[model samples]
Target: MKTHDLTSLLEAMFHQSKEMILFVDRHGEIVYMNAEAEKTLDLSDYDRNQFINICGHCMGMAASGDPDCTTCFLMSKEKLTFQVYMRTRYGKRVTYIANFQQIDPENNISVFTLNPLSELMKQQEFEHQKLLTQRIIQAQENERKRISRDLHDGVTQELLNVLLEMRLFKYTKDREELDEKIEDSEEMLSHLLDYIRNISVELRPASLDDLGVEAALKTHFKWLQKQYGILVDFNTNLNKKRYRPEIETVIYRIIQEAAFNAVKYSGSDEIMVNLKEAGSYNGIEIHFEIEDEGAGFLMGAEPKGSGLGLFGMHERISSVDGELNIDSEPGRGTKVEGYIPVGERIV
Candidate 1:
């Protein structure tokens, strides 16, 4: 094609392009901008000569607290293509993948093109959520393995030992010896029963399924007191009110994890838990709070444990359309609060 026709075609493409395009001269003046650029930058009303510095349109450069002008790629000699955050006309921050090229090396003229990163950012967020889901599944598997190992090694092995001893009773000749073996067997059987019950409760409390969440939690608190010597002040108004199995399970697990965290790390002798109904007649919700006046760590700092407990709690609560909030500050205390809708008001 002829040079004139080729130039015309190129100009038409540039003018019609959706991507923001700018031509800047050596003096940092925006000599030309396409229709998209004018709309994106909110520069349609401004005189072209007056909009001189590119930095004026960038959030990173214009930020009052942490101006990032020193890292601007335009100052570098090499042709650059990278992501940047810019401020639009309405003061909204927008992400863009920008391409900068020296159009005329002798004249020190450059062309800057920006592709909006909104869609790309959304894709990245989706990938991140997928990774988080995978990690949560892996954590659950690990927990199941640990519980399985405990049951096999501790409970199952002891039961096997009792069975072997019972088999030896058949060969006993002395009545007295047989009586003594019977007594020993009874003692071992009792201990084995307790171990089995403990394991069963750990897997899932029968009280939770048979009785309700309140009873299950009370029993768990009593056990926690015996095991960890930490006192739990549990307050609830449910009065054995039953919910859907999934909701009860999610609430139980969250509170269980929260209480365990307090016992393990809070360093305080007592923790408080509250469960009650909230909202007016139109909308009712169940809210729970676990608070400990103990040694709380920084909110955003690295966790002391595997970090899966809180994450798992969040996942479980979210599954029930509930919201969870954890607040903590070093040397103060920690509080975990959550709530879920229980449908319309019963009263």
Candidate 2:
């Protein structure tokens, strides 16, 4: 193509672009605008060579006269670009990232360009929500730990001491009434101690840190069988010892969540938990699947509760650079699988 033809095509494309563009002279007068800008700001009344101040129409106020210019991020000449939400002539809110550049090397004739900031804002909002959810989970865990410690150290111990003192009194006094009361007190304390121990373990299983993953999981499965009567088929090919602490914690917690979900929602008599080494490799793969012949729902249907349980599980898996996959259908049990290439330093 000839140079003239290429020039004409470039100009036509620029003119027809959907992005709003405006060029202002050294004195801050509007000098040029693309087709979209005219429609965007209702610029039909604007005239050429007119002292067209776009302050009120484009950005809501004149550059030099607006009182907010002092704190407005756009006025920071040191920064070439910034983003803000501004009201347009159509009286609607729109986010825009503004870029300013000086056209003249020795003068202050700067050109300003704007691009919509909606996509960036959406991404930022998602990240903020993600962080907020994590903080909520941490706060909940802290509270649970507090309650567990109180029961284990204070309530349980105090009850035991009371029982001991009561037994000593039995030897000193020969009253039928007092003896019966002591027996009742002992029974109640026994039940309470058992309850407190369960609560403490649920809060944060000490076995998880003290014992390795294998031992902790064995205990967890026993608890599941005793409590829910759910037969969980567990298999381990872990020919290795211990894993990184954070990774272990993540795996344990996800298993807890997944298994709890299975018992609570899957309505299955039998489930499966498997942990094995990826053969001849340094990585490990963990799997927890719950299969049931129960009434299920659509996969896309909104989950019960705040729906953050699964989301939290996903985040935990991501922390270890792992992948989490959920498969569920109506009348079929849900299965959640997670794979983490073990030994990969997430940091």
Number of the top TM-score candidate: 1
Minimum summed lDDT over a 10-residue window in model 1 is located at: 58-67
**Candidate 1: stretches off by over 4 Å:** 1-23, 27-93, 97-105, 113-115, 119-127, 279-281, 344-347
Residue 172, candidate 2: Cα error in Å is 5.8
Error of 2 at 56 (Å): 30
Instruction: Return the top candidate by lDDT.
Output: 1
Tens digit of lDDT per residue, candidate 2, span 130-161?
88778688868977888978877878787877
User: lDDT per residue, candidate 1, 105-219, as tens digits?
Assistant: 8878888888888877889999988887887788889889989898898888888888888898999999999899889889988998898888889778999988888999999
Estimate every model's Cα lDDT from 0 to 1: 0.84, 0.68
